[model samples]
Target: MSDQSSDASSRPGASLESGEAAGAASGTVPEPVSEGPGRAKAAEEKPARASTRPVPAQNAGPEVPKVPAYLQAQPRPDVWLRGGHQPPPGVLTRLRPPSPPVIGPGTLWSVLATALLSALLLGDGLGANLLIVAVPAALGAFFAARSAARRLRPWTAVWAVGGLALLAIPALREAGWPVFLAVVSALALGSLALHGSRSWPGVLLGSLGLFPSVAAGARWGWRGVRVRADDSRGRVRTAVRTTAVAVVLLIVFGALFASADAAFADLLGDLTPDVSIGDSPWRAFLFAVGLVGALAAAYSAAAPVRWDGITVRPGKARNRAEWALPLIVLNLLFAAFITLQLVVLLGGYDKVLEETGLPLAEYARQGFWQLLWATVLTLLVIALALRWAPRGGPGDRTLVRSVLGALCVLTLVVVASALRRMDLYVDAFGLTRLRISVAAVELWLGVVLVLILAAGVFGARLLPRAIAVSAAAGVLAFGLVSPDGLIAEQNVQRYDADKTIDIDYLKGLSADAVPALNTLPEPLRSCALENFERDLARQEAPWYSSSWGEVRARDILEKHPAQNHGTECYSLGQESDERDGYEEDSYDPY
Candidate 1:
């Protein structure tokens, strides 16, 4: 409750209660540890014995082992740290078996409800729809943290804030696969702080597979569900089971009977309640599967399984030369690209067209994605070097650092080039949701590469965590920039300057751009509104497509009122109905 793990441990009986809950979260008996020949059997049995005892009260002082005189000068936490490189907070804690998260009725309800909502939201839905799914996830993670003896990571808070921002940004949501990748990346990094996993691989493993592992436990939950107990808790259970089976049989028969006759089926349909997961076997099966998955995640969130499969062995010497030489070569290639970019920057648009012999739009299109790929490739090279670079002579280290540093600095120029290219492209061809979203990501990744380079050069060993933190910061910053609104504003500005604009496309943009569209002038404004209204007409106010963006767009349209605008916003359906039996293809449906 205090937002710190120590407070829970301080309570009488809390540890025992936590242990019992943890056991429920897993519902598995831990295998007994085999003792070596010289080891005392009692020593091996100590933990089992301790677990059986009542938790000590706060007034009952925990005996602190006295530090040796030689070690007294060092701080308590740092006394054992001979190496200057400090591992992230939770890595050392992994030495202990992972405790279960804090789970209750609240945790179960939140998980199930959120999963149901999210399953229903499967589409191109963005804006608040993204936030709608994200908050519940963050809450589920937090609940697990609260249930366990681990405090939520400071990065978890960052994760939550960033998720909120990231989801709300309409452009990112519509960006497709990249948005999914970014979201997953954000989750993995946040869980590092959330679950207090120190290893990058462990964080990745746990976050990515949290659901699968938990869902795998569905086999455990299914144990009782599959078998009908004739004497389950005696006669009362048998009677209840019988009654339930009878009710199910009757309902099935009644539905079948009704369906045999049209009038009877119509009457039955009217009487039956509208529900999402009905008696359809497929729907029921899918719903049950989702429920199992949610329960599994909730269980793990309360008590997580540790990812010990791949243990990161420290202090293995890497071949410094093998990783080093390639980096030097790549750095030189980047230096060449950056030098060429500098000349182009100074020479302006005319020079770019003159040299390339391509028009402005074609030139802009050709360069941005190529620069983006180059930047991405450079990052991979840096990351690989960090992971595999040999630790050897001081001279090798110096050379490696200088090349990496130069690459990082040069990578910034590439980043700038990519951004300039994208800006030029967007200026020529008005902003789409994907372009806006990717531009933000490009800037963020560029920042991350810069951090990676800095860590590599400065000899700060927390490269993984720093990259994770920078990633979280980048996501948060993108949200803060309000990408959807910016794209709308910028595109509107482009329309003003160029005089050639896609009115239909602007109307097709997310509701975040609605406010910005109001600034458009004259007949263009009329056409834009007409397009928007037509699209809005096709959309129905159902839970599946519901979003704040839609709500805002509808509200804006309400004020304009088609009659006052001197233009008709007619639906394709309406036109079709008027010309009844007209060819379906006659309508564009735009």
Candidate 2:
């Protein structure tokens, strides 16, 4: 803690710098050796300045200057640099002191409570369940960082909450499972990485590899609990163990006796239970383990250990021939493909389909995914090329730039093709949530490609920042559009054009679709309403699982009395109000 300058001599085993320094330390004038035959031979090598030159230090090691901790040796280059020999060194690696234990009693108790809450709230409708989960999850990060003496990046928390909102949003839940997963995963990465690792990409990679930490944290928690519970007297531990053994024996004998006697079985009834583990525990044991994992995941998220994230490969300069040949060839092929696409576009869809002798639906389904994959792979190729492209020579740079520009331009055509495919498919077969999402993704990809091209050509280099923003924007747009409602609207539009409305399918959509279905025309609306009412009736939301979606669904169904004509579950004039007087009493809010 004291401020004192550190120097080389203080460090044991450090090499001595000069004879003068050693002489100074000893305060002695050393006597010179006699000029023997060896001295004569050495003198002959430096005859011009033999006497003037300082004699080599006798038995002295080479001098090494002291360096402060903050002033370290030069970090190793990234792997991509110099075209690979060995893997890049861990640039951020440091032998840091072990972090002090976080002593936040509030944090510890809150995380434990969160684990219990998560366990209690499982199997509820996703909206409510996710809402409940996010609170503790976010708090977990805050607490963990606090414990580790790290600061939480505000934007990371913002993104995490935004993602959780997407999950909780009623209508948007049907935006496609994969889309939701991506948003949630991004949220997790942003939150964990905000304080977990040193670099953005590193945080991302490490966040995915956090299972080990989670397991360790859980084990740590359990160890902590055990350490506290084992009193020095040993009596408390002994009594607990004895009681546990007795309980197991009693349960085993009781079950056997009940099985032997039918009368006793009837008396025991539900108490005998259907599920038991090792004749000792109830099914609650499974629930307990789940709580443990949840606690572990939360603990690791909030207070992660030190992680050295992935070191990106260094960029290496390449020969002009290496950079030019592949890019030029690829660009030419892309140019040709794009030219053909443009020609076909001018000729119209019907004419092209006629030439190919294919049905509209089949043709429409063909190109969307392929074009998407090609565009994604194209970006990958551009990235790898950029990493290895030559940095020296104007001719090589110009060639790279020209080819890159052409490839980006051609890639736009491919993105457009993908969009067109989705459009054609939707036009022919009507829209679903997945189709709408695909179209949106395609549009976003187009915008991103435009950004990429602009950055590449103008030297703006906005790809990294642009990519994250554009992707998040695409997902947030889904929230704006309202997936369940959009699906209903598009399907209804399709029905209007060509009498093909599927009421059952519409009813089958999430609760978010309910309000939209209510807007449908006449008798059809009534049938859809009946289907939804019956379905919702069967999916009774337990009190703990109450969500905005469920609550609203309940209120809406109450307002729209099923006409009872379409549903087999209800007869004419049936009340159908079994849950009318139910209380939300299971949970204690305080």
Candidate 3:
């Protein structure tokens, strides 16, 4: 039995052999099996375990406390789970979307139309000019606002329109204060109503509507309150301070200048007109009130509107055509009205001449009818050219064709008029004035030809180009043949006759004479010099007036100059002709 036990213990797998071997190796029973077979195996197989006994728990001072569950594990971050992975540093995270592109023929056409309207309106009176600026600005604001909030577009439009209406008050000044006030009130109320909803747009509209009135009131009167407070001391103080400063400045300046030069005193005295301010304070106050009210109304109308998140894409081609047709029609209507007025003026000339019974020579000399007709004809031709010109084509061929046609028409008319004039003169007056008559006809014809050439060169598809060409032609022709081509004749006559002062001959002088006449004294240099010369000629005694004996004496008197005349008379008599040299050759004595 002993031998069997010994053999079993000595086997490698026997627990007794391991225990004895570990005890003999200076170790107590091998450390109790760890939590698993692998741990137990490791403990049994380790050389260090064979050399050491297990230290009892009591011997180790207070076995190291197991880590609390919360602290036992290392921290796992929340961001890592939530954010997936960190992006690279310095990379842009948010980018704006690309803007929609402007496309198609309508976009280009709209821009052109707006530009034309802007130019035309700008050329109109001050009121129209203001509208030109305001309307576009308002539209721009509306679009901007609509982009922000689509719902705000209507409100923005209302505000802009209101502002424009208020501004229009200054334009129609003939309308009394009541009308102005009513217009302003209606605009303000309408703007408010349009933006009644409680939104950002509404708030903006309300503020804008009130701001102008408030500002204007403050500007014109001290009635505006700067702050909401019970005490009035601040307001009173401000008023007093302002008044004191103004009075002090006025008094100081008045005293200082009182002792200065007479001119300074005169200027100071004239600073206030003789008109009395007394008993009219109410009128002045009313004017001030009206001004403030108008300004306020303007402000209320000009609020910025925002239409958020509204995108506007171009309409279809058919829609564009629809819009374009109306615009074209309107332009044509305007042109027609202008033409009608011109035609009326042209047809009225014969009646005017007949009523006046002016001789053809006198009529030709005056050139009032000729110039009036030319202007009317030029305008009519230009209108027709523009009307016929094609607007939406690829090239300016249509405009070119129209210009050429109009020019041809104008030239024909001028030729026909010249021929008619020649026939009338030869048949009616029997006057041989071909040189002057032909010169005038040639001058106008040359002008028309040059204009046609210019219009052809520029290829006048555009209205401005057409207008410029017509204006240039008109100005040149008027300069050349205006008043019977007197400008050219005046220089020629002056060269030949040493100072030809024919009052009747020089009646058609241009506004260009204003600057030249400025160098001379007022009354002496007046344009009335012509009338004075005419009166002098009429006063001269007719040849038929003399009796038989007086006729011979009168002829002798007409042949020689009067004695004791000044240097001016001597010079004039020397320059005069045999017909009336002996007459008072001096300046008018009356």
Candidate 4:
């Protein structure tokens, strides 16, 4: 059995001689074999192992290169790599939430709307007025409630209520309490509805919408109370209260105005003429009360009490140009119209001249010849100014400046003429044309110059402030040195001339009669006369018996060689008789 086992082992794997020979040839160390019973059993169960080959060594480098903590933690690139979570780039950096826009005390749209609404309501039928009130009020209330729901501040609501109250107060006085209440309610409700967005601007506009109603209500209320009050004390009290209320209303209304200055000016103009203090023992008391109330209300409403920082900045160049272009065009048109009208009146139609009994051919020829020269001279001056002046040139500036300068000359001339008419100054010329002499023309020219200057200054942007200063200076100079201390006085004269009133007649009237006729003072006598003339012209008198007859009669009498009738009525009494006779003759076939 031993001999047979030896033979089998030596046959292939189990040969000691072959193992020694392999170990000697390979020159490698062998691994130790397991000796435990468990190992011996594992070895018996193990399959024959394959020839082991030498394996190559792997690179001994770090798994990933180490990055700096600062680099890894960078906000931009790191965030980009992770996901799009970084702040956006570009001009978006400038984009931030904006603060609310501030609105002025009064808005123009609101004031205008209120004025229109008031006029329609007061001027139109009662039903229309009522309807107007209802619609606005309903809208205001709806908005107000909505605003409240939206957690808008109560200030908007207060302003709306105050505005409505103001509107209703005047209407109530004028139209009666019922109308006032209805209108007020309507305005309040409408304001509430329209301003539901809780926007200050909307509320402000809504408040403005109620201004006219308030003004009307105040006016009517004050007038009614004044008229009804028998006792001076009561009247005084009412006046005080009314004025106080009006001032309060004005202040409140003013808050809604985008421009405080404009609003104040308007308010003053509206209220000044109506203010009066009664001759009563309670006058001082009432006045005090009114003053206190007005001041308090004004303060509360944030009315600008004083003119600090009231800089009247000149508008942009574009605006100035816009104003200037129109003004220039208007002046040119006016001059043309005047020239044309004069020409026509003098001699365009022979029939017109003959019917009017005017020396049409002769006057036309002479007047046209004189006017042609004057127009040529004026045109020449304008041409020179335009050609040599700056882009918005010296000529343009001079157009306005010269106009203002002309006003000064004109005022002096007018004053001189007035003085002469009052036997204050006598002209060297023996011309009996005392009414509209060269001096009067000069005065008119001066006024035109000032207006032109104002336009130019207001139009130009570069030197707007300077221009405004110049304009203001001109205004001041005119106001102080001119016939009256206001530019309005000059305008009044122009208005009067257009109306065609007799200045002499107005000059002769008593002071008491002057106001009744809505006449200006002695300085503005021409204006009063002009207004009177317009009033007369507008009177629905028979067409043939008025100034038209006088004009015709003057023409015919002047033409008639035998009739010395033109000089027959120089005295006031004689003139009256002549006018009466002319009317009678014209009406009755006597």
Residue-wise C-alpha lDDT for candidate 3, range 450-559, written one tens digit per residue:
55556566643333323323333333333222222233344334434543343222333322222222222223233323332333334432222211222332333344
Q: TM-score per candidate, in order? A: 0.60, 0.62, 0.27, 0.21
Number of the predicted model whose lDDT against the real structure is largest: 2
True-structure lDDT of candidate 3: 0.40
Deviation of model 4 at 195, angstroms:
26
For model 4, the run of ten residues with the poorest summed lDDT: 423-432
Off by over 4 Å in 1: 1-153, 156-194, 216-290, 312-326, 457-461, 472-484, 537-545, 562-590
Instruction: Please give the TM-score that candidate 1 achieves against the real structure.
Output: 0.60
Task: Give the higher-lDDT candidate: 2 or 4.
Answer: 2
TM-score of 4: 0.21
Cα miss at 551, model 1 (Å)? Answer: 2.0
What lDDT is reached at residue 493 by model 2? 78
Q: Model 4, range 1-590, lDDT digits (tens) per residue?
A: 78975695576333322333344334432332457776555444332221232211221122343577678885655655657567664331232112111211122122223333433333322333334343333343333234223343554454345344343322212223223334444444333333332332333343233332233323432443354454356656876799899999977776666265877667665433222344332444433433232222212122111111223333333333543454455455545655555575477456555666644323333333343334334434543443343336566565655543343333333333233332211111111222223333334444444444454556523232232223323322322222211122333353455422234443333122222223343333334334334443444322211222223323332343121223322331212222211331333111
- Please tell me which predicted candidate would have the highest TM-score against the true structure: 2
**Is candidate 2 or 3 superior in lDDT?**
2
